[model samples]
Target: MSKRKAMPSGGSTAVPTTGKRAARPSFEKPRGFFGLSDRATTWILAAVLAVWAGALRLYKLGHVKTLIFDEVYYVRDAYTLLREGHERAWAKDISKAAFERGDIDSYLPDPQYVVHPPVGKWVIALGEWALGADNPWGWRISVAVLGTLGVLLLFFTVRRLLQNTALAFLAGYLLSIDGVHLTHSRTSLLDLILGFFCLLAFYFLLRDRDHFRDALGRNEGTGEGFGHVTGVRWWRIAAGISLGLACGVKWSGIYFLAVFGIMTVLWDWTARKRYGDPRWKLRGFALDAIPAFFAMVGSAFVTYVLSWSGWFASQGGYFRNWAAKNAHASNPVSEALLSLWHYHEEMYSFHVGLDSTHTYAAKPWLWLLQLRPTSFYYESYTYGEAGCEVEKCSAAITNIGNPLIWWFGTFALLVTLIVAIAKRNGTAAAILSGLIAGYLPWFQYLDRTIFQFYSVVFEPWLIMAIVFVFALMLGGHAASRTRKRIALLAIASLVVTMTLMSIFWWPLWTAQVIPYDLWRAHMWFDSWI
Candidate 1:
């Protein structure tokens, strides 16, 4: 008879696994809820936070009544896109009055020469289609929904990447409270929609990275050919599509697409070297880099082209038949494609030459400092005029971020840079990628008229950087209990300060009719006014 192996001590018959890495603490994975898994509990907590975020985003959404700032352009564009098949010119100064009076037919016959793409307007049209376009709620509902969902996306992304529920909650909570994000989410503009896609692409890229690394670790020694045959990375493909959608929203997203594409190839190269491949560069270029380029950039091109389906279908779309008229192409497909190319050239020229002065234009360098926040709406009222309880009152909607959060976040980025360079933390580097993609490109456009509200696109990355610093402060398992408590207290204090500042600035962000003194209190800088 075969000899039976003796069991371990303590009356246990469990077999120990060899060569497995130790996981993080069980604190991130709490016990099941009502016999359900820990995942359900996590989702429940995220939902609770999301509900609060949704409430804030949805509350008084219709209170603004009139379209503010760029909404004047987008709201009508959205309505026209739905009513007509394509965007049409509208009476800019007088059409808003007609629209507010419930005259929904404000658009004229000619297609408008718009600079931006149609995907963002299509998103707004979804809201307008759901509810009639005559109301403020219809114009702003989709942005509110996306803004709320973005918080959940950030939470899950952090939780999935780092496996830290506390850090996930902190990132999402900070984003939810940030005034710039809140303001942009409420407004019917392209930037927030653009931000949502960029954030989604980031989440997918993280998933692809995790999957790739895990596969690389598992199959490193076994592969004899050009690296381990990890199958098509669907997450990476999804990221490409999301980035494409982002480009359709605003051309600024192309920076992210290019940067992330390069970053992913670098990730693959480093991963191969880390997994014991000496000649990683050659193998990675042929095996990983080529495939990743097709996966991301190729897919982005297809998705961006598809976003112009409406314009393609419209016979009278701006320059839709320019090839037929100007080029006289015999091939139908070539004609359409050439016409689209010519249209893009015009749009490119418009963006490059956009030097018209505006009251709220700000330099990209000052965006991070919150030096000159764009005021979307502002109106003063004497007592008894428009819900004025004081002798002088003000109603305003400003896209200024929380000062403490912005200033502290700026400092946190410095910390991130140190960690990225010294500690070689990939996560820190990824956070920097978003900021670089969103903020750096604007400097080239110093002559172009841009507004501070565009900072909303990178606000999530700022919050992520802040969370990374906070995570560092909370020391590793080797830390003493006293040290942990002190670190927690400090982090708690900063969060409380951020929350209170958000409270103080809430009225200014939401266009609430308030006393002039209260409004003046919010303008910490003379430039803000």
Candidate 2:
């Protein structure tokens, strides 16, 4: 036999002894979910997004010398926590004196009972600890930092989900310009901290999805199709920790934990099916889904409890002795724990029973369309004190979303839902799922005092929805050059429009001292005013 010309090892022409195709240099590594063109462009877009988002968040972060809206509660509470290890009561109009006096510790130590969780207050405390209670910048610094980080996280997340760089940048840009996000970032508030943790949880979950898929891709040729799956996925574990931290920030995060748990299971089922396993769904349910549930949800639950370590350790936090008071025979630790549980039960009841009317409260349906926005701060200026040379002028920071972006996003969400159901496209479905997780639950609370600003929690998802629609408008990966060019132009136009809108509204969002008439001029609707 013509001595098989000694085959060169590891060359393209050489067949592997394992009976697999020799790895081609170009195909050695898969191009990830999206192709290389998509990846390269996404990195460039993400860089630009970082600059845009950072400038919006970090610039003039301390312009407002006094506390605004909920900052009145949180900034002082943070100072109290830093000095006294617990929140303390503040006098009426404390914001004015607190700013002037530069210290609030002398007014602390009463164990001020607040409605919200402690985790967010702790976050605020970090800033107070670093910058000192004397400075407003210290209190607001953490929020601005977290907000900017959120933008970067959303940019990478959208890029990965859609496999398109332009769309990712678009999502980031929308978030950067959103009034609610900008306003919240400049103030010390629990919601912004909550939003940051929620975004982080989503980020970690996405990473878990990517890593799980990669693991499956690697094991495709293992041949032991139904083998027992046992390996420490550090990413999955990290995702668990993140989900727990999310809950630590706010109980609203529980909804995400539930929604994402189901979504992750579905992802596992699909991964196994794509890898050619016969009972992929069932195997995934047993192997992948359950493990993920324990990792993400279980860990989150633990973290939530751990967040109250101060309460458990102390004897005077709200309701700390409730169980002991009611059930005298119970163990002290058990009673303390039970008392906390009872407090939560009461809080849940309050939240559900909250049907009180408020001027700023809007129905869930109105939130998506920006029909109503909460007025965080409002002041009237006669002729010149507030920078008005005209008649009646008003200066306000109204937590309203950009009209064009919100309107487009609402419509885009509808389109994405349709595309997800009809086309069974994973990208569209993922985008819709995220929006639904953050927003749909609010509908059940319609009777409650809810403001459109609360929608900041879901604003990132809305931006992603808008980007998803724009991506579809831009045509698919295989579209002709002419179509692609048109799509690019359309996206560019949208970005420019959003940028202009942001510029016009920047003063209100940042509390910049501007011509009061100019601020009023930007208010296109009576409801906005």
Candidate 3:
């Protein structure tokens, strides 16, 4: 396999433009730790991170023993979809009590009016099929699996970008211990699964950037529109498919699809200009942007439509035959299409008009600031009840992020934005794209009842931003031994501190029973309760 030179982590250092070649800085197969080769150390770190994240997510998987928060809707929908290929409504007078008693078949035969698409629930159903549907194991195992793999994905992504294994591992470690991610991973929810696909798409696009630039470099001799067409971009297609799956999970995925598609074209445009394409502006749009639009957007559209195969195949799904009842069509296929369009319109209306009052509802502005996090589950008990040795005990699952990590990441995010604008660093711009794409769109709906948990979609990018600063502080490969040591110590201290924060907050994050005072200590703001 051909190795593309990794871009520098953005800072005050002299960075390269899109096409300019920088000094190598000497990082091909650096010495490994623990008497192992560099390759062996890298894989070992990956394995260790996977195990650590998996243990955190999978430990006491069914300890809660009850469906909390959104699990009530999604876990039920998954079971129904597993059995009937469509969501069935819950029976009247049936609550979680029966569900916890191994009574998974508590749903009526009538189809339910679910707003979101079915792909996420189908993913949930896979675990349900493997384990019993009535238990927490069945409901949560799939998300745990995705959450674990997401840590590894972030590690490999940073490794590929910065080409520094230690710094890459640092990014992965930060993600694994984040509170919002941990809560979503242990519970049955669509958002984290949505996040996984979005990050996966980002990784693919990063790979495409390398391949497209390589093709451009190879064609420096030909000098015709920067080498034919750079051929077909398989990585871009894979990215589109991953993003389509994200849309299948939630409508929020559309923002990512549009933004990432544009970002890729800009990367190509920059490469053209850097290579001295005289008519780069017009040629970029004509040659690169148009094909990219079709390649990414068209593929995403097709994949999204195909994701509804389960709905189309079923006769009893909600509004399945709306066209037949209301509008006339020439054929069944056209009728199905019309019905699907109508269903989408109704879903759109519901989303726009939803203004439900809830204690934990927060504006998008407070998400990264950690002002008000949603509570997934909370239960209090007096003495002599449920392992309560103290006067009162609390078992809660709070979706607040790790404080020190987020504050540092927020700083990193600002620094990256400044570097991108002032230096026009492509690396900073690309890193910032994921955070902006995931986060900024929500601001349009300031009045909408959203939760901080949605921030999971871009949390990996936030960590990437954090790692970018760490790379800069560590200096380039040419830095002195003492300088590198100080930077490494600073990074190591942050990791150790964040790990301790996770430990302090884990009981509240996971629904473990703890003293009321301890739980209250974890709550720094009244709004957090």
Candidate 4:
């Protein structure tokens, strides 16, 4: 064989060598406690935002000084739940005037048929127990605290999900000041508690997603599937408990429980495939899906049953003796269980058959647009009355959303749905998933009398969708610095505008005295009245 010519030093026949830049590593998953980075900054910002939100909620919380709207039912029930183990019947046509003047003897001595479960009342009872039940501050304090904590929770959750501190703070701020959220926070109500628990459950599930992903990645290329992933999955169990608590507050939380359970299993399937398991589908089913049912669904069922402990432990609770009086009677435990099931059946029927008309009743489709805002409390004063200095003054607590946030956020939701489908983006898809869990279920009850405030349950998700749109505007790391700065400025302007809107609507949100015409100006739609 002929010998080949020797190549020159530092040069080859293949080509002249040229310097090439090393590729940067994939985006580093920031590390610290619970997947949060910039620990001091993140926590500091969170605490400040939480305090600000709490102050806004707590300000004038007792100034209304009386039960407003459903506060009559929930607040009174909360007090009775503390004193009596169950809600007692109220005198028919009870006088509100008497009840607000420290006359709480309106309840009759029999068990009242309550539509909602006891957990929400239990939470409210904490405040009533701590403070005096006769005080409005006591009635509303628990929900206000929950609402503030929800703002903080959203901040931490978004920060963990996107790993962006500024964006997370903005998300928290928007939710903190939004009109509907603010109003709910200031009032003694169950929906805010329901929203709080649902968001918490979602946060826990998000944490679990990462935990499972990291575990599976550690076992990369192992055909062992879930055998290596087995453990307590405490975060998932926590999510289940949160979901159950949410359901205890309202039946609507069942939608979140169902949707999140499905989403988690899908995540596991993707994780198995990414980890190089060719038999991912079957293995994921055998390992993840089956176990998840027990982990999430089973845990939720157990927790939900446990939440009714107060009702179960009490002999005089409504329907506690239904099974004893009927065919399902057995032992006391079995009778109580059966009676609870029967009570649930009755509640389901009542909810499904309800078609009562109300001034504030709104369709689900119109909720995104805020067409029919519910007036939780409204009072008109003549000039000098109630601290009013105008020709006509008004004090109101309306469940209207921040128009700037809701209207513009509607577009953001559309973008999220489109981006989710077009890019097959997991994060965008997850955002839409929460929105669906919160809002779409109401469409099934179009014939029922649902109010606009019910949208509070999913308001956090809507804010997340809006933030996702802002992320799209900010562009990727490869985008020019100038482009990114412009995007940031544009997003900042919108946020500032939302803040200004929050101020303009703050009087109505807090039931502060404002000119009648000003209140009218805030009510852009005739239906808002």
RMSD of each: 6.6, 6.9, 3.9, 7.7
Error (Å) of candidate 2 at residue 109 is: 3.5
Ranking by lDDT: 3, 1, 4, 2
Candidate 4 residue 510 C-alpha distance from true site, Å = 0.8
Q: TM-score for all predictions?
A: 0.92, 0.88, 0.93, 0.92
Q: Output the better candidate (1/3) by lDDT.
A: 3
What's model 1's lDDT at 430? 79
* Highest TM-score against the true fold, candidate: 3
Name the lDDT value of residue 306 in candidate 1. Answer: 94
lDDT of 4 at 262: 91
lDDT of 4 by residue, 1-529 (tens): 3332332111112211222211111234434545555777777788899889999988878998878999888888877788778887777577355457777766778888989988899999999888877789888899999999999999988877676777788899999999989999988889989989989988998888778867765554454444647577889899999999999999999999999999888877755554445566898898888888899888889999998888888988899899989878769888999999999999999999999888888999999989988889989999779888988999998989999999998999999888777766667777887888999999888899998899899999899989888878988666899999999999989988898988898888888888888888986767878
Which digits, one per residue and each the tens of the lDDT, describe model 3 over residues 407-458? 8899999998987888777778878888778999998887777888899999
Candidate 2 per-residue lDDT, tens place, 57-83, comes to 778777666677878878777776666
Which residue pairs clash within candidate 2? 244-300
Clashes of 3: 0
Any idea what lDDT model 1 has? Answer: 0.84
Ten contiguous residues minimizing lDDT sum, candidate 2 = 3-12
Judged by TM-score relative to the true structure, which candidate is superior, 2 or 4? 4
Question: Where's the lowest-lDDT run of ten residues in candidate 3?
Answer: 7-16
Query: Which candidate would rank higher by lDDT, 2 or 3?
Result: 3
